[model samples]
Target: MTSPRINSVSIMHYTRPYIELARLEKPTGSLLIFWPFEAWGLTMAAFRTHLPLKYYIPNLLRYLAAAIIIRSCGCTVNDIVDRNIDGNVSRTKKRPLPSGRISVRSALLFLVVQYLVGIVFFVAFLEGLALRTALWQLIPM
Candidate 1:
């Protein structure tokens, strides 16, 4: 018999619980986390210097993506940290980690992926000292 072959579709299907663990399915959480951060950053940047529409727009989009990823990481970390406590709570007992649908190790791996994507975007979008500094920010998160 041939060994199982995993493809992008299958991987994506399997990753659903982790995605839920990240709270991506719930728009409220991600929006609440990203919107203010994005608004503050854009307001500050726009206030500090006059950037052409072409430049600020792309950067704004990139920052939004970064914020979403960061928010997801925060949610995953919360779930992992609270897994035990969550198991004890009737409301949270059904969550991915507490429900035994997702392992702590798997959740951690998913968090790493989220971090890597955010780091890649920051490094690729920024320049020089900014690139180095941005990469450093990703390490802790």
Candidate 2:
């Protein structure tokens, strides 16, 4: 029988491609998406309303989560759409899709799952104007 460590290693190996496809290793994209918009907005709101730490911290985390979801979903879609072009570019040629590490069908399925998670997160954690704005962001993706 395989050891637990071996199983975990195998799982990581399996997920490596998907992780690359989402560009999770390089978090600059997600941070860029978050800080410019969400972080500043949250900071402004907290300052204006004297929002408590309890509420402020959790909402900040939710916004970060949303940023990650949006960035990953956008990357996956971009890679899928630019698979052929990416293969020709020196910098992007080794990406998951272009490198043959992942299939288009698999990427599509992953994209769908990402959207579902985003929707569930927005619905579960946000309400009123926040919820409406979050849902609207998904329209372009």
Candidate 3:
């Protein structure tokens, strides 16, 4: 089957290299981002019998959200930066940047929006009580 263009893919995204790139291509970035929080929650429960971690759950959620957004942001940035190079390589020659499926301007604007979400996540983290709970890592297993 012929590869679909990026513009059409957004309507109902699925398995594709660009989207997969957004998902970080099986890298451990998202895991690394989320595991510490889950571990902290469980370990604290193990160590401190009474410190309820319900408060930290929101931040855990935020961390997961950030992982996904940041990974997607990284993917967009990669495609943006590598547009010309991707156009040259046969494997990537049909990617959005080369095939005119998505424009450079739109790609850049989308990236800016994603980074803004990162800023919001950071700001929320700073002001959130959920953050305080995560910092107090429990005793090592």
The model with the greatest TM-score is: 2
Worst 10 residues of 2 by lDDT: 2-11
Error of 2 at 64 (Å): 0.5
Each model's lDDT: 0.79, 0.90, 0.63
Instruction: Name model 1 segments beyond 4 Å from true.
Output: 1-13, 127-141
Model 2 misplacement above 4 A = 1-6
Q: Rank order by lDDT, top first?
A: 2, 1, 3
In angstroms, give how far residue 133 of model 2 lies from its true place: 2.0
TM-scores of all models? 0.74, 0.91, 0.57
- How far residue 62's Cα lies from its native spot in candidate 3, in Å, is 1.3
Give each model's clash number. Answer: 0, 0, 0
69-114 in candidate 2: lDDT tens per residue? 8888888889999999999999999998999988999999999998
Residues 38-79 of candidate 3 have per-residue lDDT tens digits of 546545764576545675565456667755665567667778
Who is ahead in TM-score, 1 or 3?
1
Quote the RMSD, in angstroms, for model 2. Answer: 2.0
What TM-score does prediction 1 earn?
0.74
The whole-model C-alpha lDDT of candidate 2 against the native structure comes to 0.90
